[model samples]
Target: MQAIGLIETRGLTPALEALDAMCKAANVRMAGFKRVGSGLITVIVEGDVAAVTAAVDAGIAAYPKTGGQLVSSNVIPRPHADLARMLL
Candidate 1:
């Protein structure tokens, strides 16, 4: 993968919202997601660096509209092969 974007939220609803927005905003593909307990959930997307960055930004913008708290967000460009292997 050229890049990976992640968006974490306090609830499933917001996470889903973010994922939808991300997909709509860029040419990114859903990688996977994880629920880490305590209602924390994360959505992952993969694409080219610019696309991933745009998707992450779109996700962050859409998340708060769900009235849920955002935990964190990140975009990793040209990630190490090992990290990409593990994440993708």
Candidate 2:
């Protein structure tokens, strides 16, 4: 399985740092990070179901520490697969 996270929260660095920790904890492989727009970061990662769920869970948990904004994320099995293929 794969996961795609659209992080539209503040404090990009800290959020990313927390995300890194989460990914480590969840054992997820980070494909890369894409710039969606100003102050918006799209984090792309791939892993098993449990790992993806844990990553998203951790990201949501980290959102509170940032200040107020909630980090939104969505699972992208098919879309991510296509996107992955495009890159290849």
Which candidate number maximizes TM-score? 1
Candidate whose lDDT is highest: 1
- Each model's TM-score? 0.95, 0.69
lDDT of each: 0.93, 0.62
Worst 10 residues of 1 by lDDT: 79-88
Task: Identify the runs in model 1 with alpha carbons over 4 angstroms from their true place.
Answer: none
- Tell me the tens digit of each residue's lDDT in model 1 across 33-60: 9898999998999999999999999998
Residues 4-73, candidate 2: write the lDDT tens digits: 4334444467557656756866887776676656666656667776677777777777666656554466
Clashing residue pairs found in predicted model 2: none
Clashing pairs in 1: none
